[model samples]
Target: MEGYSEKQLGILLVAERLFADKGFHGTSVRDIAQEADVNIAMISYYFGSKDKLLEAVFRYRMTATKAFIQDLVDNDTMGPLEKIYSLIDRYVNKMLNEQNFQCIMNREQMNREQSPVKDLIWELKREMMGLMEPIVTRAQEEGTFYKDVDVVLLMSSLFGTIHQVVPAKSYIRSSPEFADMPDDEFVEYLKVRVSAHLKKMFKAILTHEF
Candidate 1:
């Protein structure tokens, strides 16, 4: 973020949309150039190659989320449950707001290949988990969460539940119940609805009470 100029940032934002829509392999440098209204030379000058640009896109998005989560973890006033709920709020908002980037991430994970970007994705994931692990462990140690709870599976449940709705936006929109809802209202509906559901589920998963 520091090193990038406005033009470079503009290019990356445009590339993010294109790469998300057209898959990294399906999108060409020319496509990015055309969409960003910059010349091919400018793209090469900024990122050197398509692969590098893709990596840059992944880094841009992942780093921001990682930093935000790290901040929540560092807040001393928040208890484990509060921190966990904050994480759920942040995660749900990101998935809904950044649907395109989420799509690209899901694609990359589903179709694994030899790429440096994938490695970066894993690194960011591990970093996020490291931040989350302590909060989760503290909950268990304090008897708020079940002693036998599996952190990884629990985290997966959070992601899995939210992502299932990403691909269903169109179908959901077309349904009679939501057909008249405005896009902004619909998104807020999801944020409130999904966050509440996950919070309830997480509470059930973490607590001993049935």
Candidate 2:
């Protein structure tokens, strides 16, 4: 978001959506250009290639998330547990708001073939895990979180739940309780429900208490 101009930002957003709706390989520079109402040459000039554009999209989304997590890490006011709760809330909000980008990430991760996008995603994941390590360690040292907690698996559980739930809107809507809810209401309802559920689950996991 910082280095990109308004036009570049617009192109990145359009590419994000197209890549999500149509797989990365399926979405071409021309498609992005037409959708963003820019010339193909402009995209070429900005991103160099479709692959680079894909990388830019991932970076554009991840940059903010990384900054937010770093801020939590640096903040002294919030205890580690409180930071974790804040993380849960932030992730829920992120997944809900950036569903399209999440979809692209989920799709790309499933591909076994090696590519720049996959490499970038893995790099980002490791960086994110590194950012969280100290918080988890601090909680353990403080005798608040469980000493035996597995950070990777714990994160997998947290992220996996949101990933599974956020994309299942149609299935969730089919349930009787939410059958009558409007789209706008359902999104807010989901954000509250998911955030509360994750907080409760993590509290138990981290503190060894319900």
Which residue pairs clash within candidate 2?
none
Model 2 CA lDDT for position 182: 88
RMSD of each: 1.7, 1.2
lDDT of 2 by residue, 1-210 (tens): 689999999999999999989988788899999999999999999999999999989999998999999999999999998999999999999999998999898899997776669989989999999998889998899888889899999899989999989768779888999878889899999999999999999888888889
Model 2 deviation from native, Cα RMSD in Å: 1.2
> Per-candidate TM vs. native?
0.93, 0.96
Candidate 2 regions exceeding 4 Å error are none
For this target, which candidate reaches the highest TM-score against the unseen true structure? 2
Against the correct fold, how does model 1 do in TM-score?
0.93
Error of 1 at 133 (Å): 0.3
Query: Which residue pairs come into collision in candidate 1?
Result: none
How many residue pairs in model 1 have overlapping backbones?
A: 0
